[model samples]
Target chain A: MPHTVNCQIDHLSVNIQPGATILEAARSIHIQIPTLCYHSDLCVAGNCRLCMVEQVGADRLLPACATPVTEGMEILTNSQKVRHARKVMLELLMSEHRSDCTHCYKNGRCELQNLASEYLVQDGRFIDLVPFKNYTIDDLSPSIIKDDAKCIRCQRCVRTCAEIQAVSALAVAHKGAEMKISTFFDLPMAEVVCTNCGQCVTHCPTGALVEKNYIDAVWQAMDDDARHVVVQTAPAVRIALGEALGLEPGQIVTGKMVAALRRLGFDSVLDTDFSADLTIIEEGHELLQRLREVIRDKNPQVKLPMTTSCSPGWIKFLEHLYPDLLPHLSTAKSPQQMFGALAKTYYARRIGMDAKNMVSVSVMPCTAKKFEAARPEMCASGFRDVDYVLTTRELAMMIRQAGIDFLSLPDDEFDSIMGQSSGAGVIFGATGGVMEAALRTVYEVVTGREVPFDGLNIVPVRGLEQVKEAALTISSPLPEWGFLDGVTLKTCVVHGLAGAREVMKKVADGSCDYHFIEIMACPGGCLGGGGQPMPVSDHVREMRARAIYRDDAGKAIRKSHENPDVVKLYEDFLKEPLGHLSHQLLHTHYVARKRY
Target chain B: MNGLRELVSALAQKHGTRRESLLPILQGIQAHEHYLSDDAMVEVARALDLSTAQVYGTATFYSFLVTRPQGRHVIRLCRTITCVMHGKNQLLKELETLLKVRVGETTADGLFTLLETNCLGQCHQGPAILIDDEPYTRLTPERIRVIVAEYQQKAALESENSGLINS
Candidate 1:
């Protein structure tokens, strides 16, 4: 009935908005409540009762995460009863969990391990039930590994797959103690419709789900004298890699990252941004050609509203859920894949190294890139385009393994050839960045001038909105492109698979009219990727996005076509955009897959 | 595959194609197919516009909605506290011996499947076993043998009638 509810947490009075949960009220007062199933990205599941708090005169302790605050409610977040209950809950979770923490990939970063240490939970408090249960570890997927033994039954991954991604690839199967997160008929993740997006891995509280690490393989390649290991870092990795290495979010660490990669024995440290510019050239040309075919040629076969295919997760999502709409996807390869293809072919020749001896590796802020690199069709250069893929977190682990003090490293530049990029490529890390980058180039190509936006910043398509839209009316076009001087280009930018699904539904039913759409599978684009730093929230994504835009604004060349390396790439090796060589290496097709 | 699609579509149409319709559609399929096959679940998911895994999860959550190959007649024996207290174990052993199978196994002839389920809301009639849709309550080991024999005889008679019709 009132706009505010008054509550006392730990004898401290706090006034919070009505309909606020007890957890929210406590948070407003800075009273920390430890939680497991309660993730910032998902709805309250309330299955894990670790956040229980004592209520005055109540017979049972209330789950703080699920219980709403009432006026005059008195709660104790860390009373003796609450502490004992929390400890017991931790003990129970540990009893069922495989507590071999030293060998776990998430040993130091596991939330459950952190809570157990904070609560001083000793071993042997309860009998270990892991040996009795037939737990399985599914490592078939190239991007992720799911271990049922370590799962705390928190249902975070299930909720993430359903709530955030809108792809119910994971669900709770069976009931009672037999209940577990399972795919259809408990199929291996590789065989199912899993997008290989590691949002579940990032959301999991324990080491139940994690990216399939290729640290050892990359190290082996680096160590082999016969092999020349080349590493390309994605634009998103530069902003978020700092978070995993103890630097604050929004800290630009591109120079430090290149320096660390060099110190880690990479023969050449390259930038995926170089290939990102190349993608812009290729994808921009593809969009113009499609537009020409549709609008000027009056071709009915050309699909309008061509979608960006830079995100492997979004590509797979379209393949599985909207196979009929595959025709609308752009044929340009992603930056990582483009870099890999050139590294094995053109770059290998320029550097006087055999393609077979070069091991192309990519450091990305996505788990899906691992699966992308392993795609059979990715080997356009007569070899696996990318030999191994490492997430931002994995690169951090390698940096730590090599004993490199990442924070104290001196700034360094990438190798000369295939290492230069522009501001447009760097902004590809954030949501709507691809759209912004494309508009900056496409408008210039069409009108022979910069975009009409102030300071080349497309404000409408650059935010955390679920679906962002912007319209630019083209006028005074170049004579060659003068089909009509007054054609308005409608573009939509969306991040997160859920938002992508909504946009795609409109595209499928012909409900909305748009010329181009940029879709990223992860929330906040690649900066909030499933393979980025853990503990990702809107605040973290916002900070990383700020860093991306700031990095873009500071660069001398703000357009993709202005990148000198890209211009040289076309001049020396590839004659033109969408030319014969470019088509052979820079473009790919999609496959329709079973939904199940 | 086409028939399954048609059946799921028909069920979806009857129940109204919404999230709530998933359960009734699955029930309708299980009613005819005895258990949900992979193909059947995929068809249901397609008709309902849901993921196959979500359908499988829902099907496996309920004991009655089986998700594997099942016999023509399913026998669900209550294994709750009341039924256990009322000598349900002895009745189970008698049934297993007569049927020549384990607790979760089906008969060699594929006529009957025996499974243990939680309370069937027949606590008043403890030691109850459900065969097909019928409930036989207050069962002893001797009563279980007789009930199984009656079903076996009925199956044999039906087979004989079918054989004659085919000839």
Candidate 2:
């Protein structure tokens, strides 16, 4: 058992764990201490001194976020001296910050602005240093925009990139007053090894980093009479879009979101979950073909342990860091791209509308999807496959702009022909959902039985573990797939690029053997994506994951192959999985990139 | 570029490739090449398994580690209070005129570069200037002229010897 330490904070006695920081102890007792640099997901930086508290009998005030709790320690959290120090710290931070709050994109949501308002730091006690510093704005990347003038130099983005993602695309570049987070050689983010993950954008406490929104472009597309605007919502957006509005985390707002989109003048309200089901069909068959080639034909050149390619961030990461292992990645396009390609060709032909007159838009819980849509190779439909990609936050902004009362809005169903999905598609928001979905179909195809689990849950690989592994022994397989029928198919599931890096290292060193691997760049899969709601933590991620599973459990159809619309799609158009048309539209290739 | 890669590899071999050895490796490169070129920093970053921005950040934190090209001879005039009080401006003007280049600039022939630095611990001997790590104290216009001429002569002689060897 861990030792306990007793401490008195503002005359409230509490017993906390020995290693807990003073900030944690205060939070346990509901004593809210304002902090600027402190985040629940990052390490203690202690640079921002806004959390300084007065310790009895100590000459200097201790930073509450960095100092540990001690036995019988008397701490005054909101004393006169502490309050003065915090106020002065807020004033100094505002002096350096560009205080054009109304013009900023994150005016009300910015942490520094909120603290300044709370402390009543309206008086200009210090000179504004923003005008003097040579701050530059880098808006070159399609995914993220970085404004140095609004930065507080908290290093939260730097830590998020390095610790969680293992991609140190951003780093502290200089010292003292000149110190700022910069890319390699201060190059533009698009030219460097950055994956455009947008984790940095979500972690930034100020307006320094943010997603490049396409709200105006979407609005213009909708307003144009010549263009038919069709929007598809990703599965993850439904679980977390409510958080940006007034609803709590884990609220399912799918029907409400569809209603708001319809009200906002979208020509057709579709679902990316439909394409997610299509992906499982194609990817599952591809996996089975590889298994047959390796096991039955004894092929040496064919790569085993194929990794999923649904995440654009993970795709870019592999292209940069592990370029030699490019063959291991599956060639199937992401669900959004699949939907985009189909919207222009298959959906356009069915609706009797010219392909050129249709505009494809997607609402995703990711920023990298913007970069993915803009790739040179994504124009497979003879035009730009996806004209615009909006994050979940941007969709909420559009809803508010349209004056739609999303909270009390009536629930509505998605439009037909391309809007239907299954429970497997709904669970794609969580970490291990893809692997679980694939097994549910593949096992039934091979053994002609449901997955050997209670209610087809696949419990072992369902939660937020960094890396999970599972194996199943094939028995009594159908005659076509019976290659001894005793092989134990091995699989691995990993979320967050750091865990993916570890698994890739093992794959690189030829140490591990697995048939399939699922990798997502952001933590907790797409539900905790970089473009999700702000103030993301492990608790919020867990709530979102629970909501995804709940949605999956409540669905009538629980398997992707059983999704009726997908069955109709294959029968009417594509003919079969990995057919010629599927290869041309639903699959793509990757390019190797420089490591630096 | 290949030579720079080899030099960085040699430095890494001697100093080890840990993060703490970054400073010594960078200093070694600057000591040999007279400046930390972009290619040199890139090589060091590769050797130490660090990002190029991190290497550039460390290289730029110190005033002594030059990140740009420099001439064969660098003249660092002290810009401290005591040196300024004791006619350092006149010394600077004399050097600029003699080298035909302003402060922080190299000459046309790339023979001399002039720059200003913080105190060199020679306040007692005011108006001190360091020429390629060699200090000259109590400078004047005539003294600055003689010192620059000596450096010019040394360069000429060394180039002549190299020319003879090539022939």
Q: Top DockQ: which candidate number?
A: 1
> lDDT per residue, candidate 1, A333-433, as tens digits?
99999999999999999999999999999999999999999999999999999999999999999999999999899999999889999999999999999
Clashing pairs in 2: none
* Every candidate's CA RMSD: 1.3, 1.7
Model 2 Cα lDDT, one tens digit per residue, A1-596: 54799999999998998999999999999999999888898899999999999999898999999999999899999889999999999988888888899999997889998898888886768999988999999999999999999999899988888889988888887778888888877888998878888999888999999999999999999999999999999999999999999888999999999999999999999999999998889898889988998999999988989999999999999999899999999999999999999999888988898999999999999999999999999988998999999999999888987888899999999998899999999888889999998889889988899989899999988888899999988999999999829989899999999899999999888899999999999999999899898889999999999999999999999999999989988988999998999999999999999877
Q: Lowest summed-lDDT stretch of 10 residues in model 1 chain A?
A: A480-489
Report lDDT (Cα) of residue A110, candidate 2: 92
Model 1 lDDT tens row, B49-114: 888989999999988899889889999999999999989889888988888989889888999898
Query: Second chain TM-score per prediction?
Result: 0.94, 0.96
Those runs of model 1 whose alpha carbons end farther than 4 Å from true positions after fitting are B81-85, B121-126
**Maximum-lDDT candidate:** 1
Candidate 1, pairs of clashing residues: none
